[model samples]
Target: MPRPRRQTGFAQVTPNLGEHLDREDLLAALRAPDARVENTTLSGLELAEVSADGTGFSNVAFRGCTFEWVDLSGCTFSDVLFSGCRFVRCEMGRSWLNHVDFHSCSAPGLSFAKGRFTGVSFEDCQLSYVDLSEATVDRLAASETNLMEATLHQTRLRHVSLDRCDLTRATFFRTSLEGIDLSSCEIAGIRVSSDLRELRGAIIDEGQAAELIGLLGVRIKEDE
Candidate 1:
């Protein structure tokens, strides 16, 4: 049961939001050579095929926004909040996220490969088929989140907490689960290393143990 570190001093900057931005304003900002936007809120915008690579966002709140085929690779986000947002086929590889929180967001098939995340949280979010391969995550907390069939191959996780998360059929190949407690998570049909070294030092309930024991060619018989 790793205790995730919460974000601090974020409220001080977020409360003083400057103004609500529109879709045009957001597009203009993203087009800049070194885009950096802060203390603003962008809501209810439906965008598609937009590129915001290498943009920096701080103290920004995106509410009810929908992004499809968007490229946000190499972007940096700090103290950002995403609520009721939907991301479809979005590219966020190599991005840096710090103190970011996502609530009621859906991001299926989003790629976060090789990204760096710190003090990030996802609550009641749908993240199925999300790719986190080779990503480095620290202090990440995910509660009541759906991560079915998500790819976490070779990802590094530190001080992460996943409570009541649906990780059914998720792939964790070559990823170490040391010190991670999956007692409350649905890990049925999860893919791991053939040696099962990834499960070393991991904590799981008896039912989950029964689910995993089959991978070792062990069978359990019911008592008559």
Candidate 2:
């Protein structure tokens, strides 16, 4: 299969959403054997512990919604936009997201292992303890996001850029980060999980280099 095209830049998303729902019918959808909600707009609702595994969401807009411990594994989201949504410990592993935009969303402890993201942008989101291990990402832009304790093992990050994202305690094993710049991101205690050779051609600032100095087998000494 041919490689997906790289993203040049993200376009501003302006959704002319349909229906203004104060409360989502999401609870009813979850009770079904397999829920698939399409072309809906959900906002300002709390989806607590709902399960939508293997569900499909198309042309959906979720704004200011809070998903608490929701099981959304194996779900497919296409043309979905989430702004200011809070996802706490939500399970979304192996989900496929196409043309999804998550602006200012907080998704702590969310698992998206082996998920495929195409034309996705996660701007100003909080993604702590998130798992993207063995995932395939094409054209993903994550700017000003917090990715603390996240793991991206053997993941393919093609045309991905993470600007000013906090990567504290994050692990990158067998992941190619070449041509990616980490000058403005926080990498405190970030584990390579492999040899430092994977970071070749990656850009980092002087401060970040100082932190990784020990990894290069260079010892810091007191000034004489």
- TM-score of every model versus the real structure: 0.93, 0.86
Give a tens-digit lDDT track for model 1, residues 1-224.
78644333222236646566778888988878678888898878899999984789988988899999999999999989888999998999999989888889999988989999988888889999999999999888888889999999999999988888999999999899999999989998999988899899999999999989998989999999
lDDT of each residue in 105-202, candidate 2, tens digit only: 99988898989988888888889888999999998888888999999889998887877789998988788889888887898888884468657778
Whole-model lDDT per candidate: 0.88, 0.81
**lDDT score for residue 56 of model 1:** 95
lDDT value, residue 103 of candidate 1:
86
Residue pairs with backbone atoms closer than 3 Å in model 1 (clashes): none
Q: List clashing residue pairs in candidate 2.
A: none
Q: Runs in model 1 with CA error above 4 Å?
A: 1-13, 16-18
Candidate 1 residue-wise lDDT at 24: 88
What is the alpha-carbon lDDT for the whole of candidate 1? 0.88
RMSD of 2: 5.5
Candidate 1: residue 58 lDDT (0-100): 89
User: Going through the candidates in order, what is the number of backbone clashes in each?
Assistant: 0, 0
